[model samples]
Target: MQLFGGRKQDEALAKREEQVRKLETECRTLQTSLEDTRELVRHLDQDRELLLGALEHLRPGMDVQPQAQVLLDVCFKPLGLACFYVALADWDQDLLRFVLYHEGGRFRNHPSRRLSDRSGLSERVLAGRRPVYIRTLEEGRAAGSLLTAAEQATGLIPHSWYGVPLGRGSRPSGLVSFQSFQTDAFSEGRRRVMDALTGLLSICMDGPPTPQGR
Candidate 1:
């Protein structure tokens, strides 16, 4: 009888040891998962801070447009943007028209051609009030039917493009566009960053700039 009791006790101890091992394995897995989640959160937080900081440097003021252009040059030029344009809303045409254009490295100019009331690219963007990032000119050709006639007329071929609408509420007031000579230059992350930059631009355009002559 004593031998039988001892055997039962040994069996129970073995079962408890196995259970403890299983629980420990599960605990380790849970810990690893928790650590991974924390790391992801940290990375996301860092990215958010970086974006906010960049936006802060471009915020609206008397000097906003020039500062914004500088910010855009620093941020987008390295990413392959050859030209950048900002179009203000034209109520008569119900479209955005280029108000400021930055060409070369530091020259601020205006667009020679009008983009308002166009059908394909600018029209689609103004209608949707969303950002359009094209990796290839072929994609733009397919997506921007409004620009076909103009492109053909001017003998211009856009190889790559990115555009973001600027506005408040449902009525978009303007657009910011980036053009590249290379295909597939803009990525989803770049689009998001451009969206953030445009948001700051909208705020800058809300009030007229103070005059210099006083």
Candidate 2:
């Protein structure tokens, strides 16, 4: 009877050990999931800040058009660009139409009604819905005639250009462009920042949906 009791005691201890190990594993998994949730919340918060900044143009008595233009212009400063353009995809014309443009700290509304689907840094982005950073105009492939009438009228073409598609999924509805007379003006960091800014811009203007969590 003493020997039977010892065997039963050992079995119970072994079962308790197995249960403890399983609990530890579950705890570790829960800890990882909690960390991931925290990180996602942080990113969403940052994105909200950006969206609010862009929407500040809608305040009462504010000049909405010029403010929108300048907001995009200043955002390009971090990219070290001298000029920026905002274009929307025109389904009727099957092209990207020039809407707002900023240069030399001046905003031009409806600079041109011309559709841009031929070639240039802009068309490439409109076609692919992806950001394209050009180090210099010399290395451009089939983009020699990409300048808009308004841009040409200014008598200055940026030597380098960076353009981002402004919409979600495979096809975007608009384009945001940054350009500079200096060659290789865009860096990897600048491109990444523009990606975030463009997303926020879309959220503000187009009401792009983000993950729900305040």
Candidate 3:
């Protein structure tokens, strides 16, 4: 009778320990989630302040390349963007030209891609005429090619990619893209900021005619 009683006691102790462990795990998860929420809130605040100053700097007469650089600068630190590019669509030629490409903390040349190329990421954005947010490069590759042959040879493969089309209607005039080495780099808040910036960029690009011409 003593032995049986002791066995029951052990079983109860084991169950209690298991419960403790589960509670500990739950606490850790909650802590992590809270920390993430705090960080996101902080970023949202910083982004808002930066954007206000950026708007003052981005004028219609400014060159496209300079404007691209300025936009990247505004979000580079806040969003962790490692790569950025602006590709203008050539509907007549069915091509997308990389007019402004920035990567590795510097500017670099990028090759153009055919709009009809189903394997390229730009084509997906153009076809949809909307923002394309890729959480990881693997996901992008599964749907279509993420990089060109030349890019594959020398470029850094980004873990996250986001592209927003410029203009509206059935066809967009261009694409502005940002990439990062970390997976899931863009949160919902970050995406909203990017979308806003891209929208502002579109207005500057297609806004009223200037003396210098577009």
Clashing pairs in 1: 120-146
Off by over 4 Å in 1: 1-53, 93-95, 103-116, 145-157, 207-214
CA lDDT for candidate 3: 0.82
lDDT tens digits, residue span 43-86, model 1: 56755764666666655554546755655655664456766777
State the number of backbone clashes in model 2: 0
As a whole number from 0 to 100, the lDDT of residue 44 in candidate 2 is 59
lDDT of 3 by residue, 87-181 (tens): 88989898888888887777778777678775577778889999998888789788675664445777678888899998898889888998888
**lDDT (Cα, tens digit) per residue for candidate 2, span 1-214:** 9999999999999999999999999999999999999976775565465455655643333332454465564465544567877787775666656667777667665433334434456767767768877777676544543665566788676788878887767667778887888988765755666676666566556543566998
Per model, how many backbone clashes are there?
A: 1, 0, 0
Question: Best TM-score goes to which candidate?
Answer: 3
Candidate no. 3 TM-score? 0.75
Residue 196 accuracy (lDDT) in model 2: 67
TM-score of each: 0.58, 0.59, 0.75
